[model samples]
Target: MMYTQEQNREVEKVMKAFADYIRDTQHFDLLWSDKVGYVFLDGISEEHDDFCMAPIILRDGETLCEEIIYHIACDVMEEKGKSHDLRLCGPVEREEIQKRLLPYLRQLPEYEHLVEGLFEK
Candidate 1:
């Protein structure tokens, strides 16, 4: 999923907007990943929780990958209660998430067609 120049610009814009949103809303800095060619939103509050946006030229927006840790219910495990369960999800449709960030993305041009025809299939 290589990013075109324009696509990368959009990604940079969105990353800036999202980072700003988080900083303003949460009053903290996100622990960004140091990977040279990847965009990641690594939360500092907890380890192993990250939001990665991989650039895909086919779509105007990047593909999202979320890593989260879910705690097992008390009834599910007693000895393992303190253990962690990590779930890696997505490569999901950007449209499914773009809606929630509409307020931010809407500011960009082509907001209406940003996610058009942007599925892996």
Candidate 2:
């Protein structure tokens, strides 16, 4: 769904806040996707924008495309923790945990209302 101007502003605020938090605490740089639910971390070289959001990458087609595109803040705490540790040390696992955290991050209270307001049908 296309976002209204007010919704866009709210989402931008949330994105900026979340991005700042990630940068400050986790030190991972975030790049947002034009698609609603996708954001990528810097230094991870991936050609396609589709793979940018880790959780969406891990999801099955329908769920990934539908759920992630709407709610992008569900797993902030857990993803942030993992990303922070990964940034400080190194790659701990072969699989990207951040992608798996996308849905959860979108579920966050701070973001849930925004998603509902902006994307809910």
Candidate 3:
């Protein structure tokens, strides 16, 4: 879960790029969908299912989509760790840690990469 300053910056850059892409290209309110298992860059309605409304922005201007995606990516990476203590920490702790690390992770350039990977088959 510990990330370097450089990695932090990378996450931020990627997040910003993603937000910009959504704003300029997609032009719809992007939100996270747990059903589809990735962030969707479009508006939602009452009919949508299995989706969680996400915060769109942080005080520092980072997007929530990027933060969530980064957190998921980190979770995926950490899942591979061969330590009982780490595995025992569980998804709850992973989510909590992601929330706590939002500020630093928002600054990472890999944010976009993580998001992009979400849609890759």
Candidate 4:
């Protein structure tokens, strides 16, 4: 997850572009953590079950759009329990997410292409 100055800057550019894409097609208030390089969007409605919310994670020296979509899938699912169970276990860890949720998300035809097109070079 460690990146050089140039790498981080590049990621910021890609994420901002991604956010702009989300803004165009969806209604969300985006908040970003440059520290962790994740995009957080608020104001999601439960009525929109078809919506896919994923984090934008920069992997290795390149940004694969699929990985970003997978992270967002994980992000949305992790928060789902709050509405369903009404229990606050704690914040979900990135490692835990990648370990458990990512495998399932990779197969889903959800945000894969949407994010890929958004970050086209």
Candidate 5:
């Protein structure tokens, strides 16, 4: 089903927040595709063909999108910081994201479930 207006607004919120975060810290621009639930044309990674925020946007809802944004923050831009790290080298792996960065991000409101169901050991 197509996203309702309210849900679309949530997507915009998440996209804007993420774009702003990218601009402020990375000094670059981000392009997002709602149809595909991925961010591309990032001015950061020369090696970066592209990056996908996990779980898809419309299908996954904004809460998870927010978590995915934080996931990109911690994995792609922050910790890895333009590297060949496995996290950025390919499509985001939920387990890898949860394992490598969730503990640090879990305190943040949006990332509280960064590992919830997926990372249980």
Candidate 6:
């Protein structure tokens, strides 16, 4: 799917914000509950299910929550969804995510190596 120029800009902005957040903490907890089909970061736990484990992705998700960036981007896209456009959904394809997200993350030194293994072969 091709994103509009504005959509691309928003995605970049949100990803940069997340990168800044991670840089500040040097740690993040991303949790997903298959039972609830809910993926969220640390603070939203109270509103959701018991997300005990990190998401299992093609990579070692426990250490690299790169999927979280995609999920959060999907949410942002969904909010910006137009009446004429398809509603953005969860589990955005790994390739699509890597295309849209990785470049911004790679710009940050700390995230350069961390996101390397996030994609599947």
Q: How would you encode candidate 5's per-residue C-alpha lDDT over 9-107 as one tens digit per residue?
A: 655655554544545644234344646553433334445454433333343334535444454544543454555333344344545555554443443
lDDT of 3 at 10: 44
The residue-by-residue lDDT of candidate 1 on 1-121, one tens digit each, is: 3556887676566556555554453212333343534443433343435434432222233432111101111112233332222121123323234444456546554443433322212
Query: In candidate 4, what residue range of length 10 has the lowest lDDT sum?
Result: 81-90
Best by lDDT: 5
What are the RMSDs of all candidates, in order?
A: 10.8, 11.8, 13.6, 12.5, 8.0, 14.1
lDDT by residue (1-121, candidate 3, tens digit) is 2335654454445555455444553223443343432243333444644334443423232344444454444444465562323334456655554554455446564343444433342
Please state the error at residue 109 of candidate 2 in Å: 8.2
TM-score per model over all chains: 0.33, 0.27, 0.23, 0.30, 0.37, 0.29
Candidate 3, clashing residue pairs? 8-107, 8-108, 10-108, 10-109, 10-110, 11-108, 11-109, 12-107, 12-108
Model 1 stretches with alpha carbons more than 4 Å out: 1-3, 24-36, 41-60, 64-102, 109-121
Q: Could you tell me the C-alpha RMSD of candidate 5 in Å?
A: 8.0
* lDDT of each candidate versus the true structure: 0.36, 0.37, 0.44, 0.44, 0.46, 0.42
Where does the lowest 10-residue lDDT sum fall in candidate 6?
82-91
Candidate 1 clash pair list: none
Per-residue alpha-carbon lDDT of model 4 for 1-121, expressed as tens digits? 5667877665555454455444553434334466765444533566654435554445332343344444454455555543222122234533343444344336433433443332232
C-alpha positional error of residue 70 in candidate 5 after TM-score superposition, expressed in Å? 5.6
Candidate 4 at residue 101, lDDT? 37
